[model samples]
Target: MGDERGMTRMLLECSLSDKLCVVREQQYEVIIVPTLLVGIFLILLGVILWLFIRGQRGQDRRPAVRGTAPTPPSRALSGEGAGHGENVCVPLKETSVESFLRATTPDLAKLQVPREQISEDLEKIHNGSCGAIYRAKLNTGDPAKSKSVVLKTLKEPAGLQEVQDFLGRIQFYQHLGKHRNLVQLEGCCTERLPLYMVLEDVAQGDLLSFLWTCRRDVMTMDGLLYDLTEKQVYHIGKQVLLALEFLQEKHLFHGDVAARNIVIQSDLTAKLCGLGLAYEIHARGAISPTRAVPLKWLAPERLLLRPAGIKGDVYGAPPYPEVPPTSILQHLQRGKTMKRPSSCTQTMYSIMKSCWRWNEDNRPSPRELYLRLEAAAKTADDKAVLQVPELVVPELYAAVAGITVESLSYNYSVL
Candidate 1:
């Protein structure tokens, strides 16, 4: 009876110990599960708060413009003052040709021409310092629609400088865009060797050649047979003035503006060519040392190695008017006093004289020149001007260079 009581007491004691261990495990689970869940919730809340704050910061960074779309971050801010100030926010020294092209011509892919489409055996029309210009036929999808184009290639053994110049010219055209008075860039082939820049073929060639031809004979166009009239001179002058006005608005100037640099179409339209000088001005914010600026065409300030500005372009107009060729030589020899052309009307003479003014401040702006030319064109009579014989004595041109007119054709290639 005593042994049975002892065994029953031991069993009850063991059962009580088991119940205590189970209660302890349950209590530990309840506390640990709630602590873990709270930690997870706090982590999630922190992530959400961080994301919301980041979004608010981004929104605050971009201020909206009134009555306009938000300004792009890349656009350059205008300069505060004029007179060779940093007019554009672009870094002049660091602006690579590739970056400039990408920024200005984002859709340049469409302007790329296939190498196979251009003819290999095209005739060279002109040879320039950069390279030779060839007349090529671009094969379009339709045989009849295939058109003639001018291909300007980099010279043989082209080095780093040549490549940079080629790319710079391409960048300039991209910035210039399309205009009626400017030579249109059709396409470019830069992927392959001997990179080519395709341009529209101006059929009648450059104005210098056209003027030479006209001086030799009374050229006929559109059923009108006549010499170059003062009215026609005004017409050409007006077109050039229009181009200059366009360039001025873009903060550019045609550094070399003369008949040789102007391309004449058979339709009597004059388009400006010779962008090499213009490119130099664009890149360096002044003339490049490599450029050989014709002294006769340059203003007195430019000839004296002074800084060139918009006023320098005004000096380019005197050579185009019907002045005696020797007059330029005489004017340069005499020092500062240039005689007005006797053939030109008093109004036209006054304009040319004003362009040659010793004081640049007195010179008219391109816009003013355009207006004056427009007025001259409206009031002038073509019939009386046509009666005067076209006078371009080859001997006079030959005297300066010690070459014949025929030889000048090969020697002189505009800019």
Candidate 2:
């Protein structure tokens, strides 16, 4: 009985010790599992922060893109990169006229007239400072649809600078687009020497010649007498103002504005021409005083060598003057006060006089001049306006005699 009791006690002790070992193992597992889980979470959070910082740095290295459209790739037309390796990029020092026109006017291809397709009439029209003008016919694919065009040829053997200038003018005209008051450019031929610019033919010649014709003859046209009335003057002035306003909006000014530069159509439409000076002014940002401006048509401040602004072209009086060119030059050189034309009506005279203000700021803007002329036109009678005869100087009448409308149609070419 003593041996049995001793063995039972020993077994009880062993069972209690096994129970305690199992409890200790369970406690160690609970503590170690939570600690391992927290370590894994901390490592994952550190990795996420590193990734976010890297993404922010990438964004900072590149410029932000704007605009609704994607930017086009820079194209190198000429110079090193042209016809070179695909990866090469070249920078252009200057923009070529061809490239400029292509960029600004995508329809330039349609406006181009092939040099071989043009046939000239051989008659020279008006000889101006730029070049001689001639009439030509463009051979469209359809014979009936072919139209007569004015060809202004550049004087042969033009220097590189001259050629560039001519091209710049063409591009500017393209930029101006088409308007009834402005002369339209059909196309240009720059492939060969003596580059020719094709323009639309205005049926009636320049206003100066037309006015001269009317003064010479008590002209009967379409069974009615053609006369220059005060109202008619207003009419002509209004059209010119419209043209000026158009140019002003484009940041341009007609440096030379006179009857000689105005082309009149059969329907009495006046279109402004002589864009060479205007283009020069635009390129230079202001008119140079050294230019040979028509003294009689220039305002006093302009004669004194002041830089020309939009108001520079406000004076478009008839070229025929009571004062001789030499005398006018002398008077201007002497700084003598100039007088307004006596032939103009009080209202017309007043308007022109205001344009001649010594201070350019005092002169009326093109828009203001347009409004004043429009108001004057409303008060005048059409029939009475028609009754008044067109006035021209006697010398102009004698000079322009026998130069009929038919003769003018075939004359003059432009470059």
Candidate 3:
């Protein structure tokens, strides 16, 4: 009886000890898991804090508005209804590139080009205020296929503001997407400094230069004689109006529309190019006061700092090509407007006069202009080239333009 009781007591004690051991193991595992979770959570929190701080620093370093006091970030956005006319203002904040990139999701994979793929020459075709432009060939993956592209790059050792604006412009094109009447972005090499915005090469260059070429007795681009008949002028004008219509669809407008901004392909296809001010006006709610627009091209409301309508660019540049730019605003203020050119038909001159109305409201809408152009184009002879008898040189052209030779852009090559 004594042995049985002792065995039972010992077994009971062993069972209790095993249970205790199991409890202790369970407690240890619970403690370890909580501790590991806490450690991981701390690491994640630190990473988030670091990113937040970095972003704050970037915002702090953003440059001030070019010609006015920097406004708060929450400026009013454009509205579709009655507020459309007043949507745009001036002195836009120069938004930073990285933050803008984060805000807008661009397909970097398609846009980012490797530096080695581009083959360029020593000669720069044109020197711009910010950088030099080169005519280069981009090597596609296929050995047989290569693309002729225009590489617009910044000046060496570019300043921070310049770099930011330059990259921001590239993103602006991405936002606009592709349009037949607008220059399309091919790709960009913006990963590092010495940034490049690759654009499809326009064989004939800007329309203004092409117009200057037309003044010569003979001019040809790839054997197509350069001449602008009254009907052909309507055709080109019609295409530009289409681009403006596209902008209207996107709740955007091109403020500085001129011959200088339109680039021509070999087949007389016009693609609108200058979009710096337009980018500012659309991306931000305003534009820089320092943005250079010829007074002749500016709407009256723009000069007076009133809210200009979207139809501002649709009218085409004010017709006083011979007037001194400095004297333009004064003349406009006195109610003087453009005189009709001799080459301008009564219908085209009437169209030009409609754009020159002192009051923005008095001007016809883009649709009206488009209809007129369409009606005129039906009767226009596509093959009949308008011929000019004079051979114009820079000096003679400048004398007629009432501007000094230095004032004229001579980067263009003559035919």
Candidate 4:
């Protein structure tokens, strides 16, 4: 009986030991799982905080780049009725590029100008908008018919630099005053809604029309001073050169000198009209491609994606092709290409060639062109005289009905 009792006691001890081992294992598993879960949660929270901080810092840097459209005060009060008083001035819709060009008075005009200066003449021109231009009469010492003037009002939207440019032009005119080649600003009034500038009215209009007329029809001698003669062309070329020289002497660049910006008076005197596109020599180096000016009449360095320097004017030139006699004959033939003329109008062709050289550096400076033209004007022996042969530029001839090289005869009487 004693032996059996001892065995039962041993068995009981074994069962208790097993239970203790199983309990220890379960406790260890529970503790490890909780620690791992806590570690994962801490990592996720840290990542979220880092992303939030970085996003906020980015937002603070460039507010404009964040896709937020700035609301102008003008747009906010649009369509709010006639009951609004004069004191409650609201902003207008964002000024467009076209309206800026055509409008006689722009919205910015109000910001800079005072109320008293506003006049009926200040109404917008219904044209493209780059700036506001006002037409006013100037005291030319004759009260009977006061000389008409054009005033360009410049007000920048958000760009302070552009405003500075407008101011600089004002100073430029204020100091230099008027020149025949320049559009004369008789006076300026920046007091209120419509800034005032008094400038000569170019009744003859812009340069583009002049070029087109010359290209299409035979210019009337009553209005034109020069014919298609090389000497005449050379003289005209010289006049342009002199204008360019005057600008260069002042250390200014007419950055945009295309056919469109030039204006011809009744006397056939050409004036460079648009000063808004003009830039000082100092700013040329840093001028962005966005502001690099247009492609027409541009130096190749300015055209071919090359870096433009002060020496840029000396490089990249456009190649000018003269009216080919074959082109003339083709016109005569109702638009069929003809044989290239041997050498009749070579001088005239040469002028075009020089004007259109590929390298600006190789191109003649205005001074050089002026000198050449002046020389050609005086001397019969001038090798530069282009003889418009019976077969002139055929391409030009082919384009026009009833026009041919044979149809054109140089009559000194016309001159």
Candidate 5:
């Protein structure tokens, strides 16, 4: 009877301390749910923020002009390409030849000129290090209108890297859009190993050859006089400057700027060529020591293998424009300078002197140089052809032009 009475009392009476414990338990349950929800939300927000930051960094890695081929990475991959005082663009890198072909196949298909349509002239083929440059005629599929194109092709049995490097140059051309003063990339044949980069033929050959011809008597080719005047030099020079400005705007500097690189049409349309070094520095961040760019033409920085400089030109046609960049530095350091011709007026000479300054910073910017050229052009006499005293003989001409007399291909009549 006593035990039953105690149990009934325990069941009926609730202590204030016990009630407080039950309320604490309910508070913990409510607090735990809200805390867990808040933690999950914070984690989700952090993940979203991290993704956004990653996406932004990806966008920042792209090249300046969006070229067709991505060669390799150096300054461009780190997003550090910006803030270069006169730098125009930052080029990116690529993975493999297969991937490059896969990415470029769709676009390259349109650019591929049918090899069947291109008639290769065996006699005019100029073999290069990796391939032969052919003066071929593209049929345009139309027998009536055969387009003359220069075919820069890779030799068969080429390895992967050689093919990629060739394609990189093609992509570099695509990177450099259409500019009047620059040679135009008409089409290409990059479907397989024997890749052909088709460039529009500037029939006048190179500017140095044209100048050498001018040194002799005024010759008639295609019923037109191929002569150069002071005014014409400015005209050609201004055009070349426009090309340089175009490159400068893209953050590329033509390390070797001279007459040999510029090709003039009969109408005096000077198109700049030999951009292999420019593309090399643009893609690789350094010039190849084995390149053909003249030593006297390059700044001291490029000579010492230091960081390349901006702003670089022509005159009494450089005595030895063939001296490669490797040897030119010492020639430059020893204070050997090119002759300042009478027709190569003081203004233009000033520009040349400014470019040859030992210090890179001391050189004029491309814009400043262009401005000076334009100012000088305003006063130039476009009609009077500048006459340079003829070299005593053809051998002297060959020596000055850096070519052997045996290699000179004169027309049948001239011969």
Candidate 6:
């Protein structure tokens, strides 16, 4: 009886100790378990917050304009373009020659050119780079009914390569068709001797002709076509800039942009013509330096014969306009005859300098040049007219180039 009582008492004490241990474990579990979970959640939340903040900052610095052909990453691709630019990449559609050609210009096969005999007669009247440029006969050669038309007769050795070049020009015009400052391509011809690249003829003629015949110092005061006012040049530049903007937006480059290629309409608007050298950007990741290029108005990188690209116009020599950006005017001030116009605007010169840089990395594209010109023109509030002699004045164009002002000795027959 005593042994049983002892055993029961021992059992009671052991059970009480076990209950105490259980109570301690429940308290610890409630406190430490909740703390561990909260710590883990806080760490996760901090990580998520960091990611969100970084993403927002990236979006802020990105370029607002889309469709800008992406260039290759420089070491400096640290910005939005390089960093978190576009996460959802769009696949580039493969473009064929036929598809690209069809998309850009009118059907080349349909247009008709003038005969060689007629072209030869016009060639007798005028001859230059590609031989003669003639005033085409109406209804006979021209399809687009307009005031006047000039048929560019491509001479013999106008082989398949020449035909390809002609096709290229038409393609460029077709895509860049119908801007107020862009010349219209009436049609083309391959039929009946002498291949022709026919286009709308501006009665007022080209900017070169206008400047030659109009400015007071360039021409006789009485023979001035339009005063050599800053306003006029500004207007010309403004119109040209607009067309350039359009071209740049389309990622097309006008390889030959000079006074001769600019046609002035009766309404004083300037149109861009002769797009035989325009190129399109196919690669989007970056512009490679292995592309074919022309040298004359090309940027330095292009002159080095590197791959040609958009904004390469910046590297080209200055055009005829007496703007800043080129050293041509400065060279003229030094009394020297440069191969090309280098001065138009300081910004323009810089842009061209960048465009014509020996290294493709250094050159700017035509689109960049267009933007620079537009911004520069916008900030220029000074509309003050600088004094320049009339078109009749002797040596008026000495201040500029590509001008030969003279008195009208005979009636200008528009016919």
How far residue 144's Cα lies from its native spot in candidate 2, in Å, is 3.1
lDDT by residue for model 1 over 29-143, one digit each (tens)? Answer: 9999999999999999999999999999986674321112111111101111211222222222223533544553445677788877876557766665666677888989787
Candidate 4 local lDDT, 160-189, one digit each (tens): 234344545555665554566776665555
RMSD per model, one decimal: 19.2, 18.1, 16.6, 13.7, 13.0, 18.0
Q: Tell how far residue 296 is off in model 1, in angstroms.
A: 0.7
Per residue, candidate 5 scores C-alpha lDDT tens digits across 120-206 of 443243444455566767887678899777777654433445667888888889888899889889888776434678998887777
Candidate 2, residues 1-415, lDDT tens digits: the string is: 9999998786656653587657867899999999999999999999999999999998677442211211111111002222233322231222443454445344456666787677644446654344557776888878898788787765432344455666777877888989899899999876444466899888777886676566544444434346667778788878988998899888888877877678898778899988777887777776555556555667656666766667878853333344565355455445344455445566766776677565678879888998998887787655543332555434443233322233232222210
Task: Compute each candidate's TM-score over C-alphas.
Answer: 0.66, 0.63, 0.69, 0.51, 0.65, 0.48
Clashing pairs in 3: 91-287
C-alpha-based local distance difference test score of model 1: 0.67
Candidate 2, residue 270: lDDT: 92
Instruction: Report lDDT (CA) for all predictions.
Output: 0.67, 0.64, 0.69, 0.47, 0.65, 0.51
Summarize candidate 3's per-residue lDDT along 1-415 as a digit string, tens digits. Answer: 9999998786556753587657877899999999999999999999999999999998777543221222111111011121122223332232354344444335455788887788744235665445666777888887689878887775443344666677778878988999999998998886654567888888878887788777654443345476577777888888888888888888888887877678888888999877877788776788887766666678878867777767677544543656676666677878776666665667777878788777878887777788888898887766666655556576765555444555344344564
Better of 3 and 5 by TM-score: 3
Q: Which residue runs of candidate 3 sit more than 4 Å off their true CA positions?
A: 1-107, 141-144, 218-224, 318-322, 381-384, 389-391, 395-411
Instruction: Choose 1 or 5, whichever is better by lDDT.
Output: 1
Question: Number of the top candidate by lDDT?
Answer: 3
Candidate 4 weakest lDDT stretch, 10 residues: 406-415
Using alpha carbons, what is the TM-score of model 4?
A: 0.51
